[model samples]
Target: MQKTYKVQDDEPERSILARLITPDQNPGDDPLEELHGLATTAGTDVVDELVQRRSSADHSTYMGKGKVEELRLMVQKHDADLIVFDNDLTPAQIRNLEKATGAKVIDRTELILDIFAAGARTHESRLAVELAQLEYSLPRLKRMWTHLSRQAMGVGMRGPGEKQLEVDRRLAQKRISDLKAELKQVEERRERQVSARKEAPTVSLVGYTNAGKSTLMNALTDANVLAQDKLFATLDTRTRRWNLPGWGTVLLSDTVGFIRDLPHSLVASFKSTLEETRQADLLLHVADASSPTVFDQIAAVYAVLKELGIEEKDTLLVLNKIDAIHNPAILNRVLDRYPNAIPVSARSNKGLGCLIEAVGEALGREFLDIAVEVAPSDGKLLGYLSSKGEVLSREFGDESTIVHVRMPAGAMGPVHKSALSIKPSTLMDEAKAAEEASANSSEVA
Candidate 1:
């Protein structure tokens, strides 16, 4: 029989210190700093950090007995109430650590889940977070029965503890099923909305958390999304119409940000929201231009995108927060590394025109230059074309109006269905016609 350990819930504002054990092969990659940031965002003050280099984690304790003892001393020295591990711990490991250290123990996954739980604002996000929490807590249910373990020593009481565990597991399983069913309905509704917007181009902002994606989204489309200098500040998917000059209105969306070692359960639960990224015509892979680990952050984001099977999608590397960098050489170095990256400061609106131009250029590739003739009385078609495309010239005749416009290839379905004469035009022909008309006008003058 395993020893049962009780975990005392600390005050909400208790101080926490994190621990990390890096493998021998990966000595340089430390996630403690990021974990500290997560702790701060979760409203806990980090008192100190402890790191150990080991060939591998101990199966039962996550770290060797010596390291656990060292951690216990550090916790006492720092007067920390909670200990956060940079890696996920098994149920037994958690229990063992709690009993050994006599402190509340949590792992990276639980920390992130707590952040998500606090930041979840919408019905969908709240349900997603709840479902993820339930899924994560399911396998760890045995730890919850630690108090009852002592009472189950007698034969008659032994079965009740096991039976209660089974009952709780069944209830959790049922709740998980119900949540999945509800989320499925929400996803179906979202899919219908996506289907209706198929004619418009969509661009989604995706990047590591706190990479200024929300700020960029607000800058690009004037969306009032909550933009804070904190991780996972925005969880709800926000879509707004972005009017690109010379191109047309595009549906731009800002999604929940990704992070290093993002929990699998959270990923699974947020798949519906992240599907917006997968369905986008273009992905703005935003990165923090000022962070020293910008490249690593980019890699982490790409890893998540790859998991979503959207790695090969058309992506524009948007290096944001350039204003925070003092040295031009640093920005140049980043640009040299990613030669095609668009550098911008979302807060100050620097280089926004170039960003928009790049977006227009990417979206413009899908447009077609066509000429159409419609009756002047057909204001609906004219308004639709003017709103959805760039009308180069509009000529009014006695019977009809000839309008040359550049529109998305897919958007022509409605124009064809309408009673309008449409034909494809070449750029060279349009240029020559304009030049010849200008020459004739000069000769007449």
Candidate 2:
């Protein structure tokens, strides 16, 4: 038998802070700073932070008993209402810490979920967040219902609290199933949309959170997506058409940014949104070149990519935020390590031309050149051709208008069925002729 807590609609703003330390199992970034950032993003006033050097977390509470006592003192001093831990806690640990400190307890995973719940804007994102929240809550139900007193069972009398707990658990499981079914419908629709875009190449931007991906997307396609400096600022995937000089129009998408130790539930729930990256023809692995942990961030992104089973996808490393970097040697070192990496500042519009050229070169290798003749009266066909490809040349004749264009192989399907006279272009004649001439001269010599 456990107590059932009533859900509140609107809670007052409260001061929150965190206690963290380097995990003995895996050494990585000091999560206290990131947790503080998350708390701030969730609109909670972070009053203070505490860190401890421990080989491992205490079994009952996340911190040692002495550390927990010290934390209680800090909570009292700062008048904090919430105690956020940098590590995920077991249900028992959460309950014990709350009772010991007399404050609300939240872990890193819950903090991330809260931020996502606040930032989810679109229907799809909302569904994904809801599903993740339900899954996360399912295992912690016992803790939430622990406050209720148990009734003694005798003869025909049975405790009703256990039945209520069962009912609540079943309801949560049902809601999770419903959300999944709805998400499946949305994913099917998304798959159809993706199928429609198969004629065009897709480039997906992926990187650590706050790595300037949205800024780069806006710069490249003028998409005007919500570009902010905060972590996970944009959760919805946005796609826009980008025209390359030689590659025609390609799709560029900005997706939710990846973070270190991104919750497994979130990754699973957001698969539909992340499918944009998985199905992309190319991935732009963007990183903040100015951050000291740039490499670590890059590794984190790759870890998520690996989890998504897209680690082997064709990826172009894009080192962004060079405008904020003062040291040229840092850029040199990064470039030296990643020989094919491209350095660009999305904010200042620096080195963007090179980035575009690189993308064009990668995509252009898959395109074909074709020569076609269209009637001058058929402006519709002419416009379609121009929109779908790069028109190399145009000539007007009495009977028809001749046009040479470069387009992707996938786009040739519709042109083949049209009335327009189309043929593979002999545009390689000049290069072939030059090669033959050079060979003849060398043989004569």
Candidate 3:
């Protein structure tokens, strides 16, 4: 088996000069480290890092006057190919930074977007990246693509090359619009597929990037999705049928992992792709239990889910990578903090039973306990109930058969209403009388 690195090797890596600048009173979480991670994820080799403390961000340049000069010198010293900022920069700031550093300057958002562009495999994901890239580049168009006009050999007559970049810009704008329309169609198709799944229960795996979501999906559904110890391994959503003991089968999907400061353009572009998760009946919120910032990661996932308007949906917090946690106290602390969380090891398959049980319990809470009775003549009706719901018991009672089943709450009303219409004439009369008697007793009481 081959191992994958968070950062790539070979292919002649580009030298990157990075900086982390934050305002005073900022609760900075070492954005330079994150920038380096992003650069590495994008296959760039970081050669130097610079940090500056400012009261507030510079409007035209992200760094302070003195810090900008320092960064310029550092870029020259390292002979860097590019300069990456630890935060998102305005178009003006990006232009100023690029001019000052004499290197292509990008912010954290662009770096992440580039990584997404590089990692995207599926058609929808690629389209999404193209849309996001265009959106990000739209505002930075002027300063970034200003080299549209060049000179050719001139005699007495005027001489100039074609303005290819202007054409490129226009083409990009058109492509963005085209992609939006394409994505809308894709979204509608996805909506229809999701609506079809409404008849069946759905479970979605969501968590921080590289939190073993794909591995868990493989473990649960025997899916062969690519699961690696790197960021954003699974970009597009993949769904498969998972067979359970009592429930028979349900739909389980693996979706793109969430990260801190996920680009807004990405959120906007991939909204359709993520609808799989937003529309799920249940969410398996996988967390890297061994990570130091597991709590923060959980918060990030919750924040994204809330933004998508799915925070109120049923969720099962799955603490993955339990096998990597050697400190019992730390594990105990996590358990204390998240009482409902189930710890599991995706690699070792440790404590998977607990996760499955937790999922079953979550389903139980949202399902209905239905008592269905069908006459012997309606054996087909009994089969339909047994196939669709969890049949707890069936007993023959002379004229009629009694069935107790558990089904999704939303399905109960239709199933019960259908049962009433299908009930034998004698049984229907008895049922109506029993219902009337119960109503009369309640009214009298």
Candidate 4:
């Protein structure tokens, strides 16, 4: 008989056990449940969850020494290879926790960064995520990696064999710098593209993550952006031409979704992409009508926008996902809750027409109608009026052309002094001029 030796599986997948540590007067429930969603996104199986309530976290242990011992027992009971902290843990705390529990530990911020890295699709997005990760890791490189990696033949320590901490740190630093350089190039390209849209009206979608902003974008502009039932599905800014019937064409951009307590490192890294919202002429604040904490999410988005200095922009609250509502009573409740909100089902493309019309009304500029007798010798003035203002009717009479024009409110003062008479146009000449421009552009292209 031939002797057979069975090879044991060396690289076992890591199992994570998570717990929340709340300061005094904790919120209703541990927000760590949301962290579980993040963990799922990171491809980790959460075996169990624990919450420790104390006046404050222990400076050395994050949780008290007694609680840390209890966490050790809990990790052993669950056979979990990793422990996730609901809140951010300091480098010192991370090292000390590892020494106590003998389980690899990561904090909420690191967990979020890992998810971002996994979800980043495009080269630009990956560069942004990697840059943020590096920036976050830079401050916490205090031998925590050394302590975490000092494992002896265990399932959780299935990393490279005997790799020094300094080597990993040096390699990570180089990659971080490389990613920053790549992202700077990407940012420059994006800025040039945005500068070209300075003359056109730009509308941006802003909302909490997975609030159906992408779905709304798809419904309005036929943009086939990926809209998944997951968080942070979009990282890069996606802008497209939105042609409206009465209001002309405005550039609409969908950008990265916002979440509560988004990492500061991410905010700093993704500032350029979020500038799409900052520079918007109008903001479509999409909200999840189905979420229980919808109000909180809305507040969170506004908080970030306020910090970004765009909270004062004209914003329309769009209560989306009406298809999920069943009872008319509940629908009435929601409608009553947000009296000025528009309810729509982006998935089914319902109530989008009203949304477009609402957008048109929000971008509405005051209209002016005037008749000007331009000397035939000054044909340039008539042509300028046709392009800058709207020419309703023009009749050549003798040596002058009697022209009717409608212009924006800002144009009224100058055009009125130059015109023979001023009145409201029976026909909206401005709308007509906009239509003609669109048709002409289409024909040329």
Candidate 5:
């Protein structure tokens, strides 16, 4: 079995972390936060660290010669077996770095792929992870196959054959094609499943990893999903029926968390998994408000959502882990920027009711404000109106009672069948009339 992702039986691999910070890649106060977390998650000991600040990266190698020399010395001093870069490196750059530093090297994307490849639990998720790994490594396969060419300055193995490399490339290309076809079918199946569940509104939970999404999921729906304090803990999507108090049930989904600069190939490969986000009626963008770089993490999640073409979806920003924030000023600042964001503590069950209410209000945007006229003595129909929909106001007449109600767009058909007259009404009119009635009652007092 492939067990490299977990630490070897003897000990954890000692790795020297290298990060080249360019002007555009401002990784906030902690430049190594993502990389350090990833390395720890992948079970590696950080023996040493090196950070190189540059306006532009060197084309030959990401780090400059001086920094490379410094890194080489650090590796020897620590006896590090591996080097992991915080930035994604091209195949040539990886080769150059390995040659310069004399250690195994991997980039940010490669590390992420490693985690996904290992953490993927379900068969479908495993396929997605494998496809991502294949797509990412295919471009770098040429360097890997050079040994098989048997190109030596001797008699029989004098010149390069190009036979082995070509064969491997062809095999890889064919596998990529087959994986795409299989995943395409998976995507189609996922779409059909989504279409079949059209009667239930879907609210997908998306955010940076370890943002308490699964905790909130368990709190809301008691789904019992694995909610660990780690990056990409829940890769496979899980959906649970969340019972909105006043509103009916809704399908709440928890998906794979997003990280800053997520590998493009991984995103492309998980189309079937991401389809849930796309098909969602609303997105609950959860964030770790307790983190110092909360805004940066939130922005990164948005970037991934935009990359997936769901940036404009109706999204509700949820500031989770409020219990962890000791400073009131910080929470106020988060709320100041996102005035409408709901702050909650999924662990303690604080503010979840407010979040539920907010979700109900957001989902209510799809409801139709309909004026239904029925007989004053019709107790059965009046009971249905209050139970199935929010009754805005009612005008009583000797013969008929006109009731203004807000009901889901899909539920209008059944509601209309029982009423004497049904038609769309501007919801604003009901609000204004209700306000007038309230004022009149106060004036009467």
Candidate 6:
């Protein structure tokens, strides 16, 4: 990867950022912060930024004629080589804008694809990004070859340019089909891998890009999964074992981050990459507490989850990067809004214990606390208790031994099969009923 904010000569791809805003929408302070970040991440030197107030995009150029002239002047002033828009544009609009501004123009979707292309490290991620890029370019191929001809073709085209266009279209479509089939196989394999781990408690980290999820993963499990401060720094999924203090071992997974207005093709292509998030028992929604647009980023993440049909999954809101927020009021405001959200700084290790305990409580909601009395010679049951549950304490008597343990609800069947008599303090009615009955038990203790 290129050094961030490197000297100009290395990559002189100077760009001017542009966006169209509308009334009844909150632009907030610095409406272009996200676009600026994206452009910088794609290794473009942002020369200047321009905004226009419009009810809707102009049909021909997306930007109006007057604004186009102004943009052309601005580009000339900055000697910009590119113009990046925050809105998705039709192919014709992109062509018109490029012609009007005398600079190469790319819309938000294309910019995001470029970033994904740069950050793709793994083979799976590279394939997914390539698929998305191909999908985005399939429709724009005509404009790319525009210099050849502009005449409309009718009743069996005859020109060499049109013939090449047809050839390119066929080639792109074939490649797109091939990519889809390959990704489908990847998705199937990922499903099997995730399903094999169904017996373990699985938790996945999900959030907006650059939200400190990788940092948290490293802090929790020493995953060493490439934690960085840039957006979309890591584009692959990584799973590791996290020991939940008293709750045995659990599997924790990290996935590609979400973004606002994420390209639909990219999301569909990355279905295999998102398999872990879909199959997870619980999701940790990490967010940056210090960002002004934190709520917007949070909403964007949910939108992506909804697209994946997992919006209803059990999720814990984790407000990360708490150490970066110096103002108590900002965090207090967030807490006021989301009272149940856990705040923790993955960098400073502040509040991590609380986060872990909260996770324990969430995963152990169906657990049962019981005291089982058994013969002193029953080492088999004792070993099971030690392995499957957390043994709180023990009592020794001349005739019997009583062991206090907290275990999953599923473990009750085996313990009952062992013909053990017990005192039960489980919260649910089912456990209570189970404790009250035992054919082999003389009485409930």
Best by TM-score: 6
How well does candidate 5 score on lDDT at residue 49? 88
Best-performing candidate as measured by lDDT: 6
Clashes of each: 0, 4, 0, 0, 0, 0
Candidate 3 lDDT, tens digit per residue, 1-445? 9997797645545555455445443334664655666678788878887777666787778778888898888788877778877777888888888888888888888888988998999899999999999988876666655554555635643323335555768888899999999999998888767765544678889999989999998988788888987788788998899986567688999999888888878988898899888767789999999877777788999998888877888898999998999998878888999998899998889998888877887887876666677777876778667655667776677887777776655445446654633333346457769999999999999
Q: Write the per-residue lDDT of candidate 2 for residues 195-231, one digit (tens) a residue.
A: 4564578889999999999999999998888898898
**RMSD to native, candidate 2:** 9.8
The lDDT values for all models are 0.84, 0.83, 0.79, 0.76, 0.87, 0.88
Which whole-number lDDT from 0 to 100 does residue 334 have in model 3?
A: 87
Off by over 4 Å in 2: 1-16, 22-31, 151-160, 366-445
Q: Each model's RMSD to truth, in Å?
A: 9.0, 9.8, 9.3, 10.5, 9.8, 9.1
TM agreement with the true structure for every prediction: 0.78, 0.78, 0.77, 0.71, 0.80, 0.81
- Could you tell me which 10 consecutive residues in candidate 6 have the lowest summed lDDT? 425-434
Q: Report model 2's TM-score to 2 decimal places.
A: 0.78
- 1-445, model 4: which lDDT tens digit per residue? 9999998966433545455445543344445656767777777778777677777778898787777888888778877788888788888998898888888899888888988888878777777787888888876765545545455755666545335555768888898878777777777777666644544577899999889999999988998988898888888889888897798888899989888778887876787787677657678999888776677788889988887777877789998988998866766776787788888899998888889889898877434566666777876677657755556788787866778876545434445556544445544366568899999999999
- lDDT score of model 4? 0.76
lDDT of 5 by residue, 227-268 (tens): 898888989889999888888999999999998889988888
Pairs with backbone N, CA or C atoms under 3 Å apart (clashes), candidate 1: none
Question: What pairs collide in candidate 3?
Answer: none
Deviating ranges (above 4 Å) for candidate 5: 1-9, 148-161, 369-445
Worst 10 residues of 3 by lDDT: 153-162
Error of 4 at 424 (Å): 15
Off by over 4 Å in 4: 1-30, 144-185, 198-200, 327-338, 365-445
